[model samples]
Target: MPHVFEVGELTRAIKAVVESEFPFVWVRGQVVNLSRPGSGHLYFSLRDAEASLAVVWFRGAQGGRISAGGERYDPLTGEVYDRPLAESITDGMEIMVAGRLTVYAQRGVYQLVAEVVQEVGAGRLWLEFEALKKDLAAKGYFDAARKRPLPSHPVRVAVITAPAGAAVRDFIRLGRERGHGAAVRVYPTLVQGEAAPAGIVRAMLRAVADDWAEVLVLIRGGGSLEDLWAFNTLDVARAIFAAPVPVVTGVGHEVDMTIADMVADVRAATPSHAAQLLWPERGMLAQRVDDAELALRRIIGTLLASRERELAVLARGLAWLSPARRLDRLAESFDGVDKRLVRAGTGYLDGLSRRLADLEARVSRRFDARSLDAREDALTRRVERLTAAARMFVADRQQRLELAGAHLAGLDPAGPLTRGYSLTTVARTGKFLRRETDVRPGDKLEIMVYEGRVRAVVTDGGPDAGDKS
Candidate 1:
């Protein structure tokens, strides 16, 4: 008889075997029901193109501090996606995951315990679309500021679309019909499928990354909204947003709408319309070029005329600055001032000096000649009168002297003697007297008491007479 094992024992044995066999492994798949409970445990169904398995990640599985949110990626299609996501977890735009693949023991299923998730979903993409639209609109990126003036002679272009799609034919037709080379570069990519988002995003990044393409013409012939959903992804939107060059999106038919059209720098209703935005018709461009040439000629002519006018004005200025004219003006001014100064200084000094000299001469004439002559004449007459007076006085003195002499002669003693007045002689005494005493014997006397004096003896003249001598 075969021994039967209990269900719990069987499950435990299976768990032991499964863990022992698959302890360290990695599995990639998509989640069907991704959920988180309040107990901090994660539960989900991880599947692939073949089959799906139930999964449970217990709270104990996380070492500590486990978070609930990650991005919810699109279901895997057995193709490896190598593109790196932009943002990490806790960014609100949750991603499904990428991490260690583990199996649950109690549930008896294989599952994916993801480390990360990325690439936003439909609802996430829609939210991003609304948010970006509002943001760019507020910033006026959708306004006139970000819009560049389209080139009229856009000859070479890089076309971004499915290679075999109808959009290529439309671009080719439009480029040729405009009589322009539109040199289209067809970069083959998936417009719709698992790889379509990355493909479109890559094409967009390249349209700007490559230096040849001036303005990008993102064309798709026409499509329904679902057919163009790859273009609506946030990945595509981000790629278009980051394009350095200007982007031109012509995604769906005129009636349909896609997020690519919204995020693009410029949007056209159709692929044919993108051509119009990029290049005008060749005929219009040629006409414009011709017009520009003519304008340049007219500007040259106007500049020449203005230069000629300025030259004439400069010549007139030069003529007005002649050296002879300037010298004459300065000379005239100097002459006027010099003459005035000379008249004021010399004329005043000369007139005053002349008047002063005349007054001085008149003053000199009033006293010098007449006064000097009259004083000389008066001094001479006075000197002559004084001399005459002195001479008269001398004459008077001489007359008086003569008269006095006559009187003296009249009184002379000799005359008296001659007139026989009285002559006495003393005998032997030589005495003369008016009355002579008698002379003594032996006395001799002779007397004459006048000019003719007689020698007389002194003996008789004293007492008795000198008669006794």
Candidate 2:
């Protein structure tokens, strides 16, 4: 089969086929042999355990953290720049690259021209993980003080997992075989995808609100970084941290470590390992039960033997005496003991009755005395009040008499008369002249003496009686 064409024409035909067959598709891989070109383009190989794919992103796009211009070189690689220089990205980071899948025509090498790039960083999932851990820590949720011991015998086990997956089947089978007698509730959801984080959050909320499960088991089968990316979301991490019941996370193969594993109360390497952790082997449990039975039987036998020995000792003490005489004496002794017991009991009862009666009588007497004293005090207070009221009434009468006397003295105008004073008046009018200056040359006044009345005329405006009136 050797039909030949010109070299350029052949190359052109091959290029056309490549472009037409594969337009553009999203490819996922790990970062390897990574480089940041001077122009700020990322050149790296995205590979898994299987094979590697070449990927590139422009500087304006995601040439690395903090915007690439004027950034110093990384000493490890000594390159002009680093792709995804953000703290979030590292060499071993698992990620998904989305861009046009293109192949170099001459070299036949394929590479993705990335339009957008994000680090499948654990901290993204670990962000929720750490946040929830902080919250729970502050609230003493994960404190040793609050931890409840696992139930020795769990009647029911609630599994929060994807249905029909390897995790669910393994748990149920292991649980049943181990004779755990556990009623397993499989709550299924997408383990990894855009929906996974939300699904995990809802399951956790419902479990806490409803009190539905005793313990929770979260499991996912092994997968590549891109396939398992959802488990790394913050929502999923927090959900595990916030779950009320103790959570056991069984995720990834032995190699893959996830944030869920770290935050959960327990981490199982595989879904099968998770089941084994919850329940042990039935044969081992049966052996333990048998051992317990044998120990209990030995203890019971020892107790019975001790009782028999006590009975035998008592019997030996009663051996071989004069039968009738002994019997009579024993009967009499038993009667004496009975009489003494009765007397003791009767005496105790009588003493108790007397004490009770004395207490009751003292209480009654105290109550009666207190009541009578209160009444006497009240009566004494009333009597004192009545005496004070009488005194006040007499004093009030005395005050009234004193006021009447003052009124009478004022009406008599005798206060001035008692002081050896006399009155004068103008002869023409009834104006009393206490001062000689009050009288004018033409005025006349009248005056009332202590005993009678007089009228006179003013003869002069004299200064005073002492001044030759």
Candidate 3:
């Protein structure tokens, strides 16, 4: 027979399958039948032309959607945002949502637990960015093997950014605090607007021609996809790729990925991070130095202690090698041998005395007549005890035999007749008559006494047969 599942069991199984299969998804549809309950949760259905799906957005679960790049960003501009878009969902609004699929066990229905919702519009810039990224990737511009390693500690670092921008200022400040005394020289360029692509390329060419810096750092702050399009252009990507020295990019926010970032040797989340990547932190370096000094001191102490132990051992050897020490050691050895000889002689004499005493005891035991007489008396007493035990055992057995024979005589059936009690039975059937109802009047019956049984006919057989007699 097929197994039957309880209602709760079936619901839980469905919940697990639905949740695991569609843990996260993006769905676009028109919202309908929206509800705002007092529990601070939004319940609704999203439907396309063909089908509808239920969606729930709990207040506590409401949050921004993270992109495939491992961070959240605006759906249109591609700039990172923190506020949730679920609050803007209304009745009959067409939107795109990202969430997970799960079953509501109480209602026995599956719904999307929406986290992020976006009103669909103006995504051309994002599309163009994706197309260029794909093209550059196909050209092997984003290969890991093609990327160059940055110097361990660059003495001079070049920044290709607007001289007055916060990105440059943040970079320089972080460099001063964390760097190993590396000089930062800014190469001025436009970071946004139509002229930004060409201006960035020019700054790169200038830095490459100068060739004074060990590494090139390109940086900018966060912006919409349109504002950051210059970094996504092929011109800037090619310039970073063709640079003589290694190029590091920190454009836009951590979530933003531009063509230049994909092509550069290293990518940092922000301007501060780029500087951090370029040089080791000053405090960290100091800590490392302190740790090394401590370890070195420990090593030196261990070496000195080992040498002192060796010196002590050598001093003991020298003391033992002296003539006086050797004479004292020989004198102690001679005293030990003399004491052992004395102990051996005393032990031998004690063993001989013990043997002589043992022989004298054996001779006295062999000649003792009283012990033999006492043993004979003990044997006679033991024989008397055995004979007494046998007599008592036979007497007990005879008494038990007599009692058993008396019990058998009492169980005999003839004993009751001998006591004047008679037994009667039907003569023809040989059945004992327990009551008068066993026979009718004139039926033949037998009366049994101690000696013999006598046959007779029943004259009256009724309920009052005994009273009539």
What are the TM-scores, per candidate, against the unseen true structure?
0.37, 0.42, 0.47
Judging by lDDT against the true structure, name the best candidate: 3
- For residues 1-469, write the lDDT of model 1, one tens digit per residue: 8879886777677767765776554344565575677887666665677986555555554332211222222232111122323212222233344444444556655455544343335334445555756765675545555556555566667778889888778877778877456677777788887699998878767766678876777787554334566876768767766677677888755544566777677888778787777777878878988999999999999999999999999988877787555655655765675567556655655665577567556756676777747855774586567557645655665576557556645654445656677577665444544443444434556655545546544433444554443
| Superposed Cα deviation of residue 77, candidate 2 (Å) | 21
TM-score of 1: 0.37
Per-residue lDDT over 127-212 for candidate 2, one digit per residue giving the tens place of the 0 to 100 score: 45456557646755445554344556565667777898887887788888976478777777788788888887786676667676
Name the top TM-score candidate.
Answer: 3
All-Cα superposition RMSD per candidate? 49.0, 39.2, 41.0
What is the number of backbone collisions in each predicted candidate, taken in the order shown? 29, 13, 0
> Model 3 off-target regions past 4 Å?
1-25, 29-33, 44-54, 58-61, 65-79, 89-94, 99-115, 121-135, 178-181, 192-198, 223-235, 253-259, 282-469
In angstroms, give how far residue 165 of model 1 lies from its true place.
2.4
Which scores better on lDDT, 1 or 2?
2
Tens digit per residue, CA lDDT, model 3, 1-469? 9999999999999999989999998788888999999988888898998999999888865554477656666543456755556566679888776789999999988999977566653244555787898999999999999999999878898999999999999999988887568888899999999999999999999999997989999999987667788998999999998998999999988777788999999999888889889989888899989999999999999999999999999999999997567656755765675567557655755665577567557745775667746754764575477556545654665565456556645655566899998889887568988876788777898889989988889888847576664
Better of 1 and 3 by TM-score: 3
- Identify the runs in model 2 with alpha carbons over 4 angstroms from their true place: 1-148, 317-469
Model 3, 422: alpha-carbon shift in Å? 99
